[model samples]
Target chain A: MTTSDSSPTVRTPLYNLHVELGAKMVPFAGYDMPVSYPLGVLGEHNHTREKAGLFDVSHMGQAYLTGPDHDTCAAALEALVPGAVLTLGKGRIRYTQLLNSDGGIIDDLMVTRLVDDEDDGRLFLVVNAGCKHGDYAHIAAHLPAGIHLEPIEDRALVALQGPGAAEMFATICPEASEMGFMTAIRTDINGVDCWISRCGYTGEDGYEISVPEPQAEEFARLLLAHEAVEAIGLGARDSLRLESGLCLYGHDIDTTTSPVEADLMFSIAKRRREEGGFPGYGRVRSEIENGPKRIRVGIVPQTRAPAREGTEIQSNGETVGVITSGGFGPTYGGPIAMGYVSPEFSSPGCEVDLIVRGKTMPAKIAAMPFVEQRYYRKPKV
Target chain B: MSNIKYTEDHEYIRVDGDIATVGITDFAQSQLGDVVFVELPEVGASFEQGEDAAVVESVKAASEIYAPVSGEIVEVNTALEDEPTGVNSDPMGNGWFMKIKLSKASELDELMDEDAYKALVASQS
Candidate 1:
């Protein structure tokens, strides 16, 4: 859909900070966001790898879903997403996608069973910035009478991600030092009550802190005060997520693409696969048994030249697919990308060619997480 | 350090009779953000006025550099292969993209002066 001029585009609480930092701002997901800072996309990509990077993810949707009891709410959520919500222990989080009736991804989101303050049975949810409004509307419409979807529009999200992220957060929020990856807690940080999730999109050990909008600027400042945290923008965010094999909505996956076709079958639990009640269950089930015609795979360009979005993917001198995302991967030390390719050529180690500026450059289909994902997991007690 | 003439597309040309040293304007580099790679034309390659002569790629986008006037490429900045950032760091000096032997001497008259170029930038901004 075209981004309408009249559509209400919300700005993150840290919008001013981006302008102050001389960030090159552009419209993304209905928000004016900084694509990069003076360090530029390349330097910013490298900075996030070598040190901690502070990203203003405030534009991401933060919401809460509550039902009469934990069991009911968990089952209600599972009906919409593919995750086994009830099986999740308290303080644990799962990455799942909100799907349309056709079983196509509406948006990728995180859901955590929060420690109910009043025993009200609440589930903390975070969704993509671009799809937040539609996600909320879709969930609200599908939810039962007792189930309620509350949009926390006034909250701001910040992702402090990288190798140095854990240590940096530990200095400010000591309680979080013990938290493991995909685990979350409603904790106080420097006197501000916030929800801290030990998760990030950067393929690094990091935390996504959800703070009240009013306190966001100060919290960002506090994080930046640490030596390791450099301000990162959308440019690095895209590159980091791409390197991690995560899909970006509108570019990689959309309402037209199914989870199975997108190579996101890992997200669908076995129970859900068999029960087959979700929208487009038959289509998704068939694709699961019979592989999709084209699958998303990682492409590592043999040369330094980047094969950007829309560049054709060719095999045996014939166009098979197109690149959806690509750039210089600082961690990989060369150009890396993700694109759709015919199933016959989708296997890892498959050779392909990317038609970059009319020149066919040799590339290989590599297994994703081109770099190792460094999620922080607690040691076995 | 010579008097530079500017083109509407933001290229800058410094001419001394039949030879012209060419590079993108400071405005162009700033607009492109960070230069990462440059595809320079072969030294002996001949091009007509407004023909695609080179390519400059930044972190996010790429643009073609069109020759302001028909000319024969004499030299290209090989330094850009290793140090494309030089264009953002020093657009007019060591970052000079290429030098060309002008096929038409009076074509320089069609370019703009610094004042006119600055006015164009101001109006656009």
Candidate 2:
């Protein structure tokens, strides 16, 4: 929403294209972004599931960390996040959280080591748009001499997600379809160099391509020309990630929630959990050993109404927790949600109530994802 | 249809004697995008003007639909339960939410007439 006197929002490279496509633009994370297009949220959600959906994620923060060697760069990153970056192979991606001293998450991010023989000293990073500036500052301040954090200001990121993504991407970059999940490669489409990763937040097989800002519009138009691809917006993006039970930075996890409580204990490497050197490692280690008081669990409201973010969650007439994300699951055909509840009520099928508009609606703790994830992984011999 | 009036909140009231048909205006439905579900008041329930009476859920969020006038619910639409998209398809016709038997017919006078409602919507966009 915008007001006449409100501060003007910055536009991404795809702004004009979004307007031409009839996108309903809204203010998000200090940027004027599309919330939905002519296809609508429901159609966009279903289309992404059945076919391919292209998203403008250019607002995300992209940067590089470089050092004298891979070890030097990895060591500097290890000091900040809970992930074991020291062992990360070139071109391999690791999902981890940058933490505060108490093991509280500063931001969740993707870290990818550059694969080329000469580029071993560099690592590619993608962080949340809202937390990018603080993340860069945090990483830079913690880095020692010979290691540097350089934010990429001239790039646009896009995500091509769904079952049909493979074929559409094959038309441009065939090697992208061959790559396994969580791997990155520097490639070109129609001669435009791109940094592509075979991963996405939609819980589907997809690619996130980082393109030079100058060619972002051209790159987007090329991808949109594919028959299987449609322009999806932020509205569907939230719902898709919610259905997959993925955490949205400020909503599901923040300075208050630790990885263990958010059911993201997998993000912390085993060695890191044992050695404990990162910021907030003490809290994360303690929580992992002695469990978090409340844990994140998926909630399925038995009724048609949804209990959105901040809706009170109750168990046995007493307030237990609150909903972090909830909405009508277009694919699931009913309302689905995720929230933190008492450890006792975190098990699947545990009945609870969601307070919506003063009414305590019946809901039950269900195991995520609301739908099965279809990430493409090669069959190992 | 001659007595059809609208509330600033986008509820439309078509007066047929003392029984008034109520539903969200087309403009409201268009703004809400896809209609996924609806929660309507039970028959005989009474509401003061501007009171929360129903809920219309779209894929993105659930929005509360307010009552346009003080009245008692006479009939509730059951068709919406099976076909919620009627709200997006025919919000004024088959998508009618409820019928209210006016408790005080004078409340209708306070509602916006067609031209006034159109002007209000114009100012908003």
Q: Give the number of the best model, judged by lDDT.
A: 2
Candidate 1 chain B: worst 10 consecutive residues by lDDT?
B30-39
List candidate 2 segments past 4 Å from native.
Answer: A1-5
lDDT by residue for model 2 over A1-381, one digit each (tens)? Answer: 111235687799999999999999987877888999999999999999999999999989999999999998999999998898999998999999999987788999999998798889899999998889999999999999999999999999999999999988898888887788899999878889899999999988999999999999999999999989999999999889999999999889988998899999888777998998888877887888888988999999998887888999998889998999888888988899999998988889999989898998999999999989999897797
Candidate 1 lDDT, tens digit per residue, A1-381?
A: 113265666678999988898898877778888888988777888888888999998988889898988889888888888777878888888988888888788999999988655644789999988888899999999998899999998889999999899888888888888998899888887777789999999898899999988999999999988988889988788878888888888888888888888888887889888986677788888888987877888999887677888899998899988898887676786678898998988888988899988889999999998888888889998
TM-score of chain B of each: 0.95, 0.96
DockQ for the candidates, in order: 0.50, 0.83
Give me the candidate number with maximum DockQ: 2
Q: Write candidate 2's Cα lDDT for B39-122 as tens digits.
A: 999998999988999999998778888888889999999899878999999999999999999998999989999999999999
What 10-residue stretch in candidate 2 chain B is worst by lDDT?
A: B1-10
lDDT of 1 at A195: 90
Q: Best by TM-score, which number? A: 2
The CAPRI-style docking tier of model 1 reads medium
